[model samples]
Target: MVSTALQPVTLSEFMQLHNIEESPAWELLNGQVLQKPMPTFYHSLLQKYLVRAIDNANSVYEAFPELRCILSQNSVVPDITIIHHSRIPLGNQPIQGAPDWIIEILSIDQSVTKLISKIQACLAEGTQLGWLIDIQEEVIMVFVPNQPLLLARADMALTVLDEIALQLTPNQVFGWLKR
Candidate 1:
């Protein structure tokens, strides 16, 4: 006898089948359902601090956490997503296109490859900036279109959004984890 895995699902199917409003732990990516692990205290701390930093920054971009972004053929829930004021969605609806900036904080035992792939796809689709933050490593991988990847840590500042003046350093981001 042979064993095979079941096929993945499309975003619409996943949404129709799963009550995303009641259960927000699931995300759809390239016709596949991805279940994110429960966020830890450290993760929440980082998210809260980053959100505040971006929100209070001298810029026109608004920061949102765990917002579902609907792409051409995929749906993603980024840990932190930033969009310019001019491009804000019209009404109470999910974002219909790539976000201007995306930040994903590495969760415990999470696959970094999957996170990178999502970021790359967003960048290819028109996202201006992507960040893969590994709290365990205390480092941030910066991705920008037509530019070399930057590995920032310690005091190195990261340019979050071009339309915003928010620049955060790896140390500042990770410092929130400390009691």
Candidate 2:
């Protein structure tokens, strides 16, 4: 008797067909492959501040700025991914498991349809926190599983990532964009 085997489509396999060359700052999210654009002046400013702030806080967890990960069949590259020190996986590829926190810096290339699905997928995949930063609105939509999201304006403080007891004030974060 002969047996037939089934093959599964993996995110890594998908990326291979995408021409994903080596770039220090590239990521893939949910089959929607992309290379991060040259950070607009504002993007670079916010990214630097976020990385610094998280690093200085000294959490037991690790926070990676602009990290890439494979979420099921899709490749998601979040702006920042904070993973529990214990949960972090071992590998040279870096992101071996779901991150504890994910930050997506909204960009012109992203669509509303795309962002919502990716956020929902992350939440379901063991990511504890997710933030969608809308640069023009200076608004952030914070997501935590089984809870109402906390949306912040420039003045409000968002305690989305509580692992380090840190809260982000929108006005303060956006201020980094000032010319």
Alpha-carbon RMSD of each model? 3.6, 6.8
Candidate 1 residue pairs that clash: none
Tens digit per residue, CA lDDT, model 1, 25-92 = 56676566776667888888888988898899968988898888888877788899888888788888
lDDT of 2 by residue, 13-57 (tens): 655664454443444454444455545667667777887888778
Top candidate on TM-score is 1
TM-score of each: 0.90, 0.81
The number of clashing residue pairs in each candidate reads: 0, 7
TM-score for predicted model 1 compared with the true structure: 0.90
Q: lDDT of candidate 1?
A: 0.81
